[model samples]
Target chain A: MADEKIKSPKIQATEQMKQLITEYYIDAKTTKLPEGSHKPICWITSGGPVEFLIAADVIPIYPENHGAMCGAARIAPGLAEVAEKMGFSRDLCSYARADIGGALTESGAIPGGLPKPDFLLCCNNICGTVVKWYEELARIFDVPMFLFDTPFIHVEKPEHATEYVRQQCLELVKFLEERTGSGFSLERFAEVAMLSVEAVDLWKGVLATAESRPSPFTCFDAFIHMAPIVTLRGTQKVVDYYKLLKKEMEDRVAQGVGAVHDEKYRLIWDNIPIWYEMRNLGNLFAENRACLVADTYTTAWAVDIRIEDPLTSMADAYTKVYLNISIDIMLEQLVELMERYEADGLVMHSNRSCKPYSLGQYDLSRAVAERTGKPSLIIEADMTDSRVYSEAQTRERVEAFIESL
Target chain B: MPVAGVDIGSLTAKAVVLQGREVLSTSLTQTGHNSRVAGRRALDMALDRMGLDEGSLGFIVATGYGRTAADFAGERITEITCHARGANRTHPEARTVIDLGGQDSKAIAIDERGKVLDFVMNDKCSAGTGRFLEVMASALEVELDDLGSLSLESTSPASISSVCTVFAESEVVSRVAEGAPKVDIIAGIHQAIASRIYAMAARIPTNEALIITGGVARNIGVVRALEQKFDTRIVVPEMPQHMGALGAAIIAGEHHE
Candidate 1:
């Protein structure tokens, strides 16, 4: 007999969010045409300073987001193989491989691939791989590139490192002015930075709703809803979307609704999601009565961008991102999240494609357990590469972990 | 009322039948292509030994790689939990369990009541598992049962370095060609498995008294090597392969009430 699976009710805002993403992509794709918006398209890293581009009236494109799209669409492995055949090592980040392979093949989740970039923006705060990934893209498209270096924070963000990043923010402004053939506007940047802060605050508010018992949404929901926060952070559209998302979450919480049916355990997820397995993982957890109420990935965007001094605050906020900090600091943040979310346990993805995120996970797992007396399960798999994933093995581990909880 | 537990592993199927706290009978059989059939056969054999039939069982819990295939099971649980419960039952002092099964190996940390605290398993790799040793034994032209006793006779064990099963098999073949003693090669294979398991098992706290369970626990050479690596005496419960089935049976009894 086929078992009746108890699925979490679909969030009402998903269709609206999808439509918003479609419109964002359509707007980005049209900007490349001579008769279109005529706005210069800058391919930026997921952690790049997109607010500057917004202020400069240039359309920002995120290849990392596009890589995630391909992954969710289940076409990443095929695309990544193309790059592997082109002599790129399989050990390279799957995101880079998928994006590069999509560019060469002109096939992806989106037709005709992402519109060509007039310029490339690379940030090392996320990982060192993006530096080379963007360099390759710049060479391929024969475009100017901006490299923003954020030094790793061992204990705290040093004044010199912050100043160094702050100086780069200035140079980034000049770079934007030169590329767009327009003058830099501090007034415009200030307005964009304020909107960026407001959107991020709303995003945090949306995520915080998970603190309620029988959380309104899971981290899988957050991963989907986070698209606007990552892609269009400085715009009013992002602010409006998150406000709507937050309200829906509040209503769900007030109604005592949960993302998982009969939510028995609340888990905190660590690291980037396995994009291809998101739906399956979500269903598997929900079936076991575990709700992944929070995660470190989506909350990476929740960093406060103080608008008091736009450039300095941007420098500090971008430099001290979740990935760029020391393990000790990451642990503190993780422990805090566990307590705030009232998590029953933690699930960490030991992502093969991401070294910085995956490294020190074992230590962090041990530390978190010691601090919170909560068990942690580490699953080894690549974020975008399905080849590295073993379905039977992963299921067994997850089931066993849930049983332990 | 009698309760039963069926463990459908990749290589074997095991079943344990119990009434109250006492084990009535146990059975083991090779798991061929169809796991559901193997599960039923194992359970039936155990029941037949006790002169009881399927209807006699009050509850049936299933476990292992093919646990879900046993549709007759009242509950399906992972082999990790089963092994921990089984180990704790056999050796109540067991706080840590290293289960080396056919296709996978796992290190589990359990509480006083045998509830799992944390666990780590080999990631999609065949190294440090029973299958790895089976491949090496076949490559050495030695019987699987003789591998443990044969390795004990070697004074200087050959060094087999490859972690991949296929590569390690080739390494053993080359050692055989180079006139290395079969005993030494076999001993080296055990050492390699021990080292790989040690590296993974070290991630979790290895609180003694540590116990080894699963099909691989039947191999004395691997147990000795693990003892040397962990620097602790390891307990091997009687009928090590039946631990998961035994644990499932115990859980079945719990669920019956």
Candidate 2:
């Protein structure tokens, strides 16, 4: 049944993107081996500052990304159960549980699990769960951990808050220098920051291509193609990848091709993609002629970093992320995305795993509807955990939402 | 020409036959295990009542949870759209339609022309649905139909804190063990369902001229409880469970025309 419903047209770049992600994971897993680049492995959060590690010639590994891989492989439930049996609440972030379970059991989609981290770096900008999730990793691996605290932006990004994060960036530099027993050159950091900014710009351009009518690619494509921007940021490869992707999308748009056949409704998605059900959902929307053109999750990594003062700008950009901001600000951004994409409606994933992303979604949905007069549908499911997901319920709501539109 | 609509829900199947705007006949039956068979049976029963056969129907539309299983249906529409169309046909002034069915519940907002503007449904949980009341009825050893009348006798409704069906059933048992009146406990169960529905419905812009439909609408206790919660009069149509089927039949007639 799902096979027939999942016949959404695919983008040509998907094959290249899959190869890129596979190579990225293989490199991370083999970093410490004799045949691999003998670089130190540092486990970092998805929203953590990776340019610093990249500049220092350290391999930055994202357990959150690995959790997503586990989810996509349909092994997250078994991995999460290991943690659940160990007294971790089922309500904890599935990413954290899956990662911990993968680490403990040494079993996941990837062979030998993720390489042991020499150090752990976590940022609370994404969610508070990472603070404890990384701490647990630190305890399990007996490694040094750094918690780069970014204060929640309630109304505005205050100067002191930016300064606070700026000071931590400096501390992070020193921490890397002392931990690696090497001098952290400002010139090298600036170069990596430049590449990071360039990649972000290209990624933003890639996403903005969907602004064209009958968008060439849906957010499902973005969710899969966003690997490099999240994992390989501050590198020439990410910039090159986005250039290729952006051109493909532009060519598709010029050829009058749409992600969904005979696109009837365009929608903006909120929160994270349901990692496990991406194909099912993508196909479901395509079958309905509804294209999820824009989303807030992948767009979170498209930050604007100024090269004039790399440290200060990076601090400000990282401090003011999509998930770290207030609901009112989120509404404004969502409304902007809706207008930019000419969306007919909104779909919000009320993820049970990530509180920061899912909380206040109801209010945000209401505000978006009031501001843009567009209806929003909130589907409850975890980002990685499929146990909480009800396929029948989700299908009913999604079909009903599309019907209403 | 006559058109027919079949609604194969999780627990029951309903069918309605319509000629122009007037309802010719309606039938209800247990869905049992096979939705496809149940859907055919329902439509056949309604056709029997009207002294007609499948060949006489101009069009057939299927709806409800098991709409997809009805391969015999010429068209399949979701219950949300069907309920909105059904309620709007019955009460043209109604803008809000609340449907509490066997295993799920939904609150739909429709335009004056019976087009769905927005809707919200209870999540995978069965707390605010007819199944919850059925479980509570079995736990309290009372007939499901008599629950509404018995609850009306309660001077003070007992408090059911847990909204989960399993937990609430245990709460009902404990209340009974403590010698609390069954009427009060039943009233409390209705209030719990009302509150759950209210929280979900409040997410949308619920307007006045509200109509309640589905099997649970027969329970006056829940209807009155919802009326008090929304602080508005809720019109329960004569054949609440048949609304989805009737709406499908109306849509079928329109399609045929």
Candidate 3:
């Protein structure tokens, strides 16, 4: 009884892709890439395999980056519906669902505008979501899946992990050398390893822009800018990108321009953003002259900590990252950031989409402000799905709070 | 013959003293770690506003995530029931209630007589909630009150993807990295939140007589974004944030009869 003229092309394309994923395209590994100059397409995480991929000239794509794109485009909703249709619960994190679902519905259930991968690489730095996501993708596509297994860190990383992951790094190098026509770039990597480290120093500087009384930018920008590091870390380009970003921040600060109206306060924000409303949130903050000084992402970058030699030091550092460890360690890191940034207060976001990250936030919030003498505020909401946010009420409470401060 | 209501939420409690349909007084504060302390604090604050005591002649009701936690109250009602009653009283024609609280966002459909029909709630993520805005507000160094007004000035907006509050922190940091304008980021957050709210309301049959309640209703910026998306006038009580509490008291009064 509905008008057929109103049908959407986007929906039609999705239907076509679902059919293709269900049918024709066989895993190409059964037949090798046309034995030419073309390199094997590789899937990369924020950490793992970046140096090795570049050494072998393998084209790299970060799945997390794709996941973000799906969210920004509101593509997560449809993909999430597809995942739910496949029996995944609606309550599952939409980021995870959209990533998997987008892959299924994208240009026929493949990464749209992306080359078919010859190999897949992921690490144990971030969360279990990445591992499971890659596992399913590998199973569906039938490609070689290589996991850069980093040992779990609770209190502190054990000494054995250093040698273990380092040896794995070397193994990674050999794997790439055999697959590609290029030789093992040992000296190049030693150089690349150190180069990657310096980028961190620059990244930290760029992040420092948030310290401005009226921060020139916001946390969402950092999330966008982190893509190059995920995709091009070892390459000189990633380092160059950070340098340029740092320069812009310096310029913003020098002009005395407020990211918000008259940044009279500095606050630290906890948790991820609601992708559905990143732009609006930032503008609202700018009008108040409040700037975010530090956040948890400063640690996510530890995923790609450069190893001095594919044999030592670097892998150990990667394994020790705050994210690879326990909440207690994250707490320690939180204390460090709050103190280092000299922030007046803390804003804790109790996000429902990611239960793990937000689980202990209330306790942590209490501890940070009570134990450390910093003012703390806790707000609850969802990050991706728009169904969760209430702007007017939030505005009222926060305004009164700031004025009170 | 004005009636009053008090709503105590998980994080904060509110008291909106109503005289008939007009708001006489309203107050807000943290709920503390325990709900009892929070509930008492809220009640006392409302009493203080009215220059009266707990031994008043009117009715009393309690509502919110911590409705049952309000042990001293004469009556208890679900936030849904309280919201319906309050919204109906605010705009007699309101067919829908969109209430965004500190921890949850809800969309309710009501019949012409203020009877509840269908409702949806997003209690899962902090991304689309006030918590998300609070985080970004802290990061941007902006006063919370100025957030809604300043965000309207930004020409360009930033895209924030992390649905988890934890990861969104990383995203906001990255925004700072790229030199994206702070106001733009805040504005984007408001839009993101509004989109979530509108989508939920759309799921159930809705009409122009929409009412918004909860503590977040005070944010003008969120109201603007929601208005643009819903494409209809939004009816909010003078003390929109305390409608839940007010409804609770009204219910208690009726029940006492």
**Best candidate (score: lDDT):** 1
DockQ of each: 0.87, 0.75, 0.04
Interface RMSD of each: 0.7, 1.0, 13.4
> Lowest summed lDDT over 10 consecutive residues: which window, candidate 3 chain B?
B1-10
RMSD of 1: 1.6
For every candidate, how close is chain A to the native chain A in TM-score? 0.97, 0.97, 0.82
User: Which residue segments of model 1 deviate by more than 4 Å?
Assistant: A1-5, A32-37
Per residue, candidate 1 scores C-alpha lDDT tens digits across A13-72 of: 888899989998888777554655468989999988899999998888898899999988
Candidate 3 segments exceeding 4 Å error: A1-37, A107-113, A302-311, A387-404, B1-257
Give per-residue CA lDDT, model 2, range B168-232, as digits (tens): 99999999999999999999999999999999999888977899999999999999999999999
Q: How many steric clashes does model 3 contain?
A: 99
So what's the TM-score on candidate 1? 0.97
lDDT of 3 by residue, A302-356 (tens): 4445353445766776676655777788778888888776777777666766665
lDDT per residue (tens digit) for residues B1-257 in model 3: 43445677866887665555556666787987887778777777867877867666376666776655777766655677778777887678888998887777878778776666655566456656666777778888888778988888878867875566777777878888899888888777777788878876765568888888876787777887888899987887787777787676667656655
